[model samples]
Target: MSLFRKITETVSKGVSTATEKAQQTVEVTRLHSQISGKRREIEKLYVSMGEAVFRGYLDKDLSRAETKVIPACEEIVAIRGEVEALEERIMQLRNEKECVCGRKVPYDTRFCPSCGHPFPEPAIPAAEDPLEEFDRQETEPSGLSSADPFVEPPGYKDPGEAPSASDWADVGKPVLEEVPSAWSDAGQATPSFLDDADAVGAERADSAKCPGCGTAVGTTAKFCPSCGTPQQ
Candidate 1:
């Protein structure tokens, strides 16, 4: 073959190889994507199957699948262990005591400041180093310069504590007068206005006088019975 023809042929072969490699790469990537999608679908199917099995048989106690239940229980135990490990790590990092609400508190804390729930004092080991304990207490949580802002400090007073003399400023202060009872009266402990009304009516009837002629009027008279004058 001529030199020019050889060079042209070599270039064509190289171009074809490059194109083939590119096509292979594209095919490989497409296959990988399909495999990933299939894996996700399989995972979802497994979850659905577990849900169905548990709901139909194991949960209802009709039958148990040791194959499924045992594995699930093992996973749960593993997960719980991991969670406890993580919590211990967090507690160590934060140098805080755990509250019932999963909130961090101080070692010396008597109660959860947030929830007001009392804390159980942990038993101390005799061989424990005082320096380490002090350092642990001194170490603050990440992102905090000092103790957790939500936690009350040493010697802090809770709002629920019994009121002191200073708190009694408003205690002895005059309260609003209570409403009078229905039966309250000067004669009784609390006389009603109806009683006074009856007395007033009796007085007016006994001393009934005419407005125009000053004549004495009967209790049921519309006008003076003596002078025939109208009673006001």
Candidate 2:
């Protein structure tokens, strides 16, 4: 009788464990389904909102579509919050936390064993002054000093010093004697080329004679007045 009772108790305990597991599984599955439905609803809202915005853009006025867009956006935000809560509940049910690497680790783990990712640390309230924190930086000393006298660069000369003759030797001087000008003053000596040009002009003026009448005509006369003949 004792052996039979012990066997019956053990069977009942196993059945209870299996029933609890089945209920948890069913609850997780239901949460996932609700999350999926909410996500689908969000997607539909996004599509409708996008279509409305695109229509507004085509119309060149976004204010007219804000009525539909704002409500849809609000609904999406609410649905996302619900999805996040459902995911958290699923994690709790599975006794695991997801790492940034997408690996599920045990809830109490400090770091992910598979990827060696460290979990986020608890936030500590800042006690230091935000403005004064920049004062902590170490500044490098400047190589230049305000007290030092200004040093002249290489090849620099003092403006007060008089220039030497050799300094002026490298500079070019204008040759006034080489360039000839016809407008030289009477006191100035005229160039030889100018004298030659003036002599040639005077000689041509004296030799101009009318070809038809042999009459003396000025160099500018086109016809001889003495004979009424054309002069070449």
Candidate 3:
């Protein structure tokens, strides 16, 4: 049902309940008055019986007393029973449980199905987290100086001291030398005899030694340059 309808229903039930109790109260009060009236009638009947007996009329009074006083007493008992029944009904009404949605819920129910409102919960001690307790225990100091081994000793420096140039002598920057060109001799062009040194084993191919006179000669010559030797 809608919230508005539920509220309306709850209000209607409450008003009707109040009216019913009011009616019951009226009925109980009426019954009490009836009981009181019946008691007074019984008392008056007893007084009449006593007066009749003192006048020496016991035998005549007995029949009339039974007809009046006994009925009155019976009425008082009946009224009292009605009063008790009405009182019990009042107690039952008081003990009834109702939800916000106008639904009749049991007294011991924890939650309402229609409105979803939970009843008051009994207070309970909360449980501690084991991990949190362990962390707290670890935070406490051990009171011993040798507890930690990773701690640095006295006089210990992070990077020792700054190094000097002498300390890097073996690892210093190298010096590079300019290489001389093989095709040049003292900044001038090289000689052809030196160029063909490897091909003739350091002997020039255009110039040969005369075998008989040990003089040098050109390859196209008919005789040696220093000795008169015939062409071979």
Number of the top TM-score candidate:
2
Provide TM-scores for the models: 0.28, 0.47, 0.26
TM-score of 1: 0.28
Worst 10 residues of 2 by lDDT: 176-185
What candidate 2 gets wrong by more than 4 Å, as runs, is: 119-232
Q: How accurate is candidate 3 locally (lDDT)?
A: 0.62
Tens-place lDDT per residue, model 1, 1-232, is 2435555897999999999778766665655565556556556656855875777674776355555655666665655565566556545544577868776765655555455566665697679888998898778555765554687789788888987887677876777755535542345554457789998888776776768666555455554434445455
- Best-first order by TM-score: 2, 1, 3
Worst 10 residues of 3 by lDDT: 177-186
In model 3, the runs with Cα more than 4 Å from the true position are 57-232
Q: How many residue pairs clash in all the candidates, one count each?
A: 6, 0, 0
Pick the winner on TM-score between candidates 2 and 3.
Answer: 2
